[model samples]
Target: MENPPGTIGPGWLIKVSSRTARPDPGACPTHLRTAVRPLVAAEPPVPFRRAPREDFAPGPLFAALDLWEQGGWSIGRVLDELRSTRGAFRGRNAPAHPSLMAWTVQAFERYVAARHEEQAAARAAGLPPTVPVRLGWTARTKKKDAPDARGGQQYEHTAWGRQYASADGSVRDLWIPSLGRAKADRAAAEKAAIAHVMANGAPTPHRRRGDTPPEDATASTRLPERVRVFDFGCADGSVTPLLDWHRTEVQNRFMADAAPAFVSAATGAGTRPGASCVDCKAISGCAALHRTPRLWGAASAAPMRGRRSVSAWDLRLHGECPAQYHLVRQLHLNDLSAENDGARRGRAVDAWLNQRHADRPVRGCRDLPIPDASSLPAAHPLEGPLAHVAVRMLTEHRVLCPLNGIGSNEQVLVQHRVTAYVPELDVVVLAVPDLLYTRRGDWIWRETKTASRPVWEGRSLLRSYPQLALAVLLFSAGALDADPRRSWVELEHLREGRGESRLERIDPSQPAVVAEAREVIADLAQPLLDDASYEPTTGRHCHGCQARTWCKPGTAYVAEHPQGVGRHPDAAEADHFADRGSIHA
Candidate 1:
């Protein structure tokens, strides 16, 4: 029997994947502990249920790749075989989208082209032909002085990617696949891969500890002279060599730098409930998580509706274009384009405020030093005119800080994930306010936004910022465990210069405000809930759409309007790729 949660047995191992080991400035440390640590029980463990996806799952794509490479089947034949295998490409209990077939074909062709290019380049360089191989590296070490119940720790770094080697196994290549454009690997993850590649010997078939080793297992453990990461793009079927390291370069690096981080990931504590909460097994005992029920006022979904998460951003994206929502948000296909200036400035301002709000002793921004273009904090780097504008905005925020008059004992949460579940809708509604602090006993939800221009006088505030509408609804529904009469929502609009920022407060206690908030949210959300096809609608927003490369209508729209005339300056700041609600508000 395995030990209970937080107690490691003798068989327990502290293993970390490249994905889990990489630096995520926003990641919850407790999440890392739950993922890599070995204290989980074998019996009915903490149940974590994820929403069923209607988008493409990569299992079938890779499986098809295997059939094409190992079984010597043609691409068409592999896809046909894949289609015949029902439930193979699906997610959870949901069926795969029909568009995935086209995506798979494009991805497979790209893979083949990448391989051909690799072989050609090798031949040109007078290198021998290489063949694909099933190779994995697991670098394990036993720590002398362990922390928990276990006497020692087995620290493991596993390499996950497609592998290829020369006939003599002297040269090897690791191909990493991405559904969209290939991007650079995280520094820590790249280093971990190097450590794994250098520490392990020749590849062998995986088996149980007591199982006999295969006769063909190579004993000649020779380190390759060269290691390269070939990043394959499934969206456009392009392959880019992301990283190439010589053996000397790998040997020169210190292996000890990664050790402390590995141990810390296993032993780290604290909870941050956001996107990770949806799949967290330790959520039951997490005190940091604040749950609010029936916050969205969504009607009861039909029987057998798979649980899903909803956020203000989701409704915003769906309203912009449903196809963009499905392709960018659900499918997660991006062209790796740079964000526009307004969005970047807003993000910088958000970060700066969050940092100030998160300071110890629960102080306000009233006394903080204003930053200039050169003196801005290293974490929130802005440039050119926007940097100056951000500085002025930061100055304006001093008076509007929620902690200014609040009692010392009052709670202050900045950029904290606020989650609520609508039982009727089978949906989890998420919101992350710029600042959430308490005065007396009432909760104050503040949303800060930076804009080149001021809020249009004609538009309703609720329609201008839908998040406030959601906030009003949540607080009015008693989501924060406080009296609605005392609690209210705030929108702080910061523009360049002193005394120009406007702070608008909405009383959620008022029936008129509550009704308007409901209508604002429902008008945007109802169409999304009813959407089944997610058809593309052509507009100027398509020009800035990240997934437009794969969307025909969006592509056509962008092509016709190459000048990018009608794209909203603020829309560029919207976060289309955030797994949960972003601090972009």
Candidate 2:
């Protein structure tokens, strides 16, 4: 017997239970019948009475909407029903605006229009029309006619609820998203979607130990294939696979274990508060997090707004930690910082570089002007000692920098932003360079990275960084005349006032270089299209993560990992991709 995972109610259920017992072979050997034994003592017969039915109390339309989601209704199916009876929808949660009602209705309109045209074409061709089935949240099953009768009558009712099966009734593309709801919670979407996925009839490959064959079968149980679920923010009725629930082999094994540590799983506090617990409404009720004051900081923090386009910073953070990415980007948690003071200071220097370069407006050997503390705007935080440090770094770069005979006469594009449309990825690729200048009529790009450790010790490591690799393609495909042999992109490290003496050259003309460059960029950019692909990879960098207090895995890793928190080697380089300032905020 076991209690369901997130229940506050008193509900217990047998772990391995069946509605019917082992069958008797005498009645029907092929399809076994329920076993029956002769009664020793017969009791007085009682009048037949069916189970009492509760009155259907409609609270609001949103409640039914939620129930349909939990019931695994397809997007088209749910929207079609909703569109027909929107005016008569019960409940206070019905949309206040008519436009809000059109969200799913629009999607349904397209589907219906396409179907009508398909029917017309089929009729003209003298063929049968293929009408798509809009399945309701019910399954047809045979019910026992009498107490002793076995599977005599069939009726339509909910068993586990219908998953969003395809037109041909395939379970492969089962996905449910909370559409067109503005205050829609991520947790609620996950709960509704995952429940539907589990029940949607994906066949599991694994079998139970105490299983029986058809000869002695009662309940014809089969392993349900694993169902993949995607949770997207602001889904807009589109099931974009932006993120998915990826369980490690260990996690899978643990969940599949016959005996699991229920107590530990239930009351177990997170090793450390992470993005998952930041705005958790149940923290006060949770005994594990109630005593932890450090985690409380996240709850006080605000959230971030949604994004119109994706950036390198977006990809990197989402790759590093999906939870943190959601908190920073989806929630717009601006008050929280993802990087430490030193890395943030480096970004401040980048801003200073842009300002300094803009003043010269030339491609020759130039000097970076130091900013005066008094000259900073009221919003700019770099003042006093911080301002002095910024000036000192600029001065140090002027003297120690090794740039003299690199570019001939091409104009310099400081803080240059280059964009390319990648149709395969369904989004534009953003390739921003610190300084972009041309050589031999080909644009040469140089990116300044502020890191405690050298980003790339050797030239071989240049191919590994997609920001540079992607720039090669973005520049070549454009009118920039980015010749592979003449033009090159360099990664300059801005630690202790040192710049790249020799830049890494890109041979864009070479078939190998072109193929490799696009492949690398595509691999990174492609996953962003799907919501499920954004999974968090916990590592030593978790210690310095600003969202660490909100990340459970991050905290657990900090406590259990060998790196032991603080500043990791990859921290600075990874954070160097902050949307570089454009002189203004």
Candidate 3:
């Protein structure tokens, strides 16, 4: 019988199908294009390539698997999902299929099981389950319970000492052999040795007389019966020796065993006979007066031939400008050049003269003309009255005033009125802006040269040594009668410039000058006697003061009130302990 039209014989089926069917698009392109064709019913499933084991390490792969397993996904479920989301054949050449999925699932299961084992091991070791316990007081509490009779209870002290219950239920100390008393004994011995050395060390001079006897046996015995002089700020001890000689001379002249009463008076002591006593030593006497002037007489009188000789002791030089006495003893260091812009301008002009004619000697001229009375304008409110008062004061004192003038090279020249004195040999120059003398008794004013440009335009000279001025004032007022001419001011200029020579002059003031100088001397007298109100005026003048740091009002006030700020109780106790123990050494 003939077969149906739709049916084909089995023998012909393979050849006919192979000849009629189209190539599968899903087949590898390279294999499909090759000359040889496979005689198969369907394309063989493409083999997946496994990644090199070295490429993905076991650790990271295992971790990733553990994460997936912990999230409630089974190995097969995760693999299927991954395959659906990302094509099965993801590699360039071939699919990384079932093999990769199986390996990943196995790794995940192993990682999860390993992690659980690790947690169990940690718990077995008595470690915290997850979080760590903090160390310190929080980790433990102090036990107050006592041991019972059953067995024995053990307790630990903060110092790590142990206590154990005895057979009778009483607690007994469990000695730790390592903790010996030797260490504490050694430390105590060292401390004791240090303390003993300190106690036997030299003691500081006690301020209280009763605590320590005076070095000088006659300190109390030589009370007001002797006159004592103190020369403070005695630079180079120039005036000290002279005062000593003078004291000897007075003693010889009077043939007296004690200092003259006049000497006590000059020292700011009352004239009362029994008010004060003088120490034979100059420094001691001065210190005594500074400390206790009430015991010293206001006025010290020298009895020579039954007549009291005028004498004074106690010379002091303080402040930055000790050379001030050089000017004030002869001429006042007025605010004239200090205050007037014109005067300052003139000084600048003088500075230029100094630089231009450094080699040429310039003489300072005195007695210049004054401004015409008519040229002066009518008095203004502030300046006029001040000028009038100054002029009146000057006129009353019969002092001559000078006029301003312009010198060669457009330099302003003005004469300064002053009392003249003979310059002394071996004199110490103590200030800048000093005066130089010419053959004709004319005075030339000069200033010290500084590396920096002058604050005023002209070259400036050190005028007067403030220390010297103080010395002179004190000496002339008989403050250093016991140590006269033994001291003077010392002026030091950093570098040499115009008029660089150092000069010195005796503190001899003219009669009229001395008269006016006495008034100033009196004004400053109280300060030497320890008047608290006697503060040095603040200004540029304070810039060079030696005691500026300690004497400054603000600093002094703060130093006096340190306790005003709250202090910790512990700190206070420490300080108290330190203070008490300090003297023991």
Which candidate, 2 or 3, would have the higher lDDT against the true structure?
Answer: 2
What does candidate 3's lDDT look like per residue over 1-585, in tens digits? 111121222111111111012223222222221101112111222223232121221223333443353455576665555345322322322222222333334434443454355347645965333221111010011222542331112211011111111222211111111110111111222222212211111212323312322344223221111111111111111111001122223334322321121111112221111111110111121221222121111243221111110111111222212222111111111211122322222233233323323323332222322322232233211144433432232222112111112233332222111111111110111112222222222223322212111122252211222223333443344332323333332222211133322332433344433344444434333233222122233333332222333233423443555553332222221111110000000
lDDT of 1: 0.66
The runs of at least 3 residues in candidate 2 whose Cα sits more than 4 Å from the true structure, single-residue gaps closed, are: 1-308, 334-338, 360-396, 399-409, 479-485, 497-505, 531-533, 559-569, 580-585
Q: Residues 1-585, candidate 1, lDDT per residue (tens digit)?
A: 232243333435566665664666666666666666544532334334333334544655666777777768887887676556444352234444444444565677778888888889989988877677755665555454554543234555666667776777566777778877766554654564544554454565676543434434545566677666677777666777766666665544425445556666666667665666554545545566555544545565552333345568778888888877776777776666777777677777777777778988877778666556765667767877878788888888887777876688898988766765453453456788878888886788888888768888999899888898988887887667768899989988888866778999999999988888888887887787666667778887887777666567777777888888434675855542134362110
What are the root-mean-square deviations of the candidates from the true structure over C-alphas? 5.9, 25.2, 49.0
Task: List TM-score per model, in order.
Answer: 0.73, 0.42, 0.19
TM-score of model number 2: 0.42
lDDT over C-alpha atoms for residue 214 of model 2: 31
Residue pairs with colliding backbones in model 1 are 343-573
After superposing all C-alphas onto the true structure, candidate 2 shows an RMSD in angstroms of 25.2
Query: Per-model C-alpha lDDT, please?
Result: 0.66, 0.40, 0.24
The 10 consecutive residues of candidate 3 with the worst lDDT sum are 576-585
